[model samples]
Target: MLAFRIVILAAFAVAAIAFPRAAIAAEESCPGLVARRGLPIVPASLAADAVQLTYIGHSTFLFETPSGVRIATDYNDFVRPRTTPDVVTMNRAHSTHYSDNPEPGIKRILRGWDPAGGPARHDVQFGDVRIRNVVTNIRQWGGETTLRDGNSIFVFEAADLCIAHLGHLHHTLTPEHLKQLGRIDVLLVPVDGSYTLDLDGMMEVIASINPRIAIPMHFFGLSTLDRFLARAEGQGFTVERRPTPTLTLSRTSLPPTPRVLALPGR
Candidate 1:
């Protein structure tokens, strides 16, 4: 009886190890982007499938998925949302975009910069949401020198929607960057003009991405935001200004044409 029990225990251990390895292999073979075929069409009554976005001030925006996963972009000490986020993505372009000391409650803290000066790589999966990044360069503060792979464009995929947050992007994206970004349904852009990319450069970036909805962030005040809105309008984008800073969006609920949404800061 003792010999039979030992054999069964060994079999269970081997099965446990082999199952995880097979799952990992399967996940590795899958493509990075979600395919757009055979997906169920979300109905008007099923607004619960939408993802919620809330502006937290500056570049910080809180994203809540349908499965209750919360993510905060450009997380910093100042302008933090009232509720704790399950995951936080930070950029080190300036103090306003990142925090050295993050709240202990956060499950995952994804930094856009590598301490070793290499590119920051992240492809994390939490519940129904998947987060990844495409590295980009930025100009050093008060200098003409450029830092390679200094910042990241974080991509969040949930509920059949692909959302991208451009963190302190300084220049136009290259072909490789575009290839890596794949299809972005929604975009969170920085319209600070001087601090990030200039108005013209940013406009070009937006054109290249061509997201279904563009939400402006990282701007100082209304003036900068208005300038971006005006330029985007010239490019045939409809502008919708919201009284509140929160919006719930889904794939089926997306506008027939691309539009710019202005959400007031809370």
Candidate 2:
């Protein structure tokens, strides 16, 4: 516990010094902007240059692009949307995060781990939206053995927006991972506290990503979600509790200061 606390403290100090200025400067339209709480989020109509993200539940999200392509993240049987999506991405960390039997009519099923015994690699283009992935490691059930290249962090590029869905992430990203990530506008992150990275390490991951907007998911209850929200607030990020489950953001709608947008869902 002491060592964990020390890591948190060190991370806090580093984040306090590094993230704010960098996140602000990340967007040209956001420089010299002041951070504020309760930033207004306009319900996105998904304009010509925008994309939409609707939280289904858990780590699953339905991403709709302007060109009419749909992508589902963490395509599990437990929390799939009613309508089949054009493409689906899944992680193998848990049974609830992926499905053994996906719908045959579904166009593409991008699993994080390859069934043939290797890391999954994907770079598929769907209309104006392009989907790709960066492989990451995961801890097996009960935190026993660490599996190398067992999971994926999928990035969606649409309407000039870069959104990343970190599926069942168990560890902080390496420098190489960040290099592949580049700049991210929105992030879908897990905040289960125990199942994925604890609040401390998760915050560390957010600092490393420095996304303009972050929406928390993969939590079992409200309290677990609140802890992650509080951690982001402590790191000087503005927290916005959206009344709706869907969040729409384009380059023009991106927040100047980094923000944690809490959409209502699982």
Candidate 3:
């Protein structure tokens, strides 16, 4: 198993929480590769200035850069891409959000939490992609415990675009976090209202990041996704539910106004 937070929980009472999942059981360790339940994964051949993305399900997304470097976010046991990626990012909120055993072909495995008792720090330049992270706090043991450096918001820079995945984020970004993130072209966010931050706080986070495009993820089902779409529409942001979960975009293809694109996936 990859390193997990097993230290004693903090005695301090948390005022709020981060992420909580319904199911908990012994994890089934497997190669984080192979087709997900036999779903066909179309091979990507991106242009020199474009990026291809597939919403694998939940918080997991497979991103192919212009240079053919592949990256997977929130790689876990339940969801993943068919082809092995060069890099994989995992969040430790629960088993559904991370994998106990990642496949061997993956060159870089970035964990949101550090087992050495501090925030995770990463800034890697691989192939044609530059990936980094900003540490955040999380609530553990069902909101009663606090882990100061529990979560991470990973930012990937490639093809002259900045992409971010908000992994089980608990709170809004502070000035420092925003500064570290710089400018994001596309953002992958969580919209499961109760588990992560509430809808309103998530909206606030979106505003703070102010990405050109925002895509909702970790929404367990359609009702949850619909709720987020309605919330986004009410906030004056444009909302569009795409016909497919697969996409390819570039810096020049961004919408005139910030828009929320709901890609169908688990």
Q: For model 2, how does the per-residue alpha-carbon lDDT over 174-218 read when each residue is reduced to its tens digit?
A: 777876777787888999888888888988888888887889999
Of candidate 3, the 10-residue stretch with the lowest lDDT total is 1-10
Q: In model 1, how large is the Cα lDDT of residue 98? A: 93
Model 2 spans with C-alpha error above 4 angstroms: 1-45
Which candidate do you rate higher for lDDT, 2 or 3? 3
Judge candidate 2 against the unseen true structure and give its global Cα lDDT, from 0 to 1: 0.76
Taking the tens digit of each residue's C-alpha lDDT, what string does model 1 give over 226-255? 888998777667787877777777777676
Model 3, 126-205: lDDT tens per residue?
76677889899888947668789999999887766788899999887777777677677789999998888899999888
List residue ranges in candidate 3 displaced over 4 A.
Answer: 1-44
TM-score computed on alpha carbons, candidate 2: 0.83
In order of listing, the candidates' clash counts read 0, 0, 0
C-alpha TM-score for every candidate: 0.83, 0.83, 0.82
Ranking by lDDT: 1, 3, 2
Candidate 3, overall lDDT?
0.77
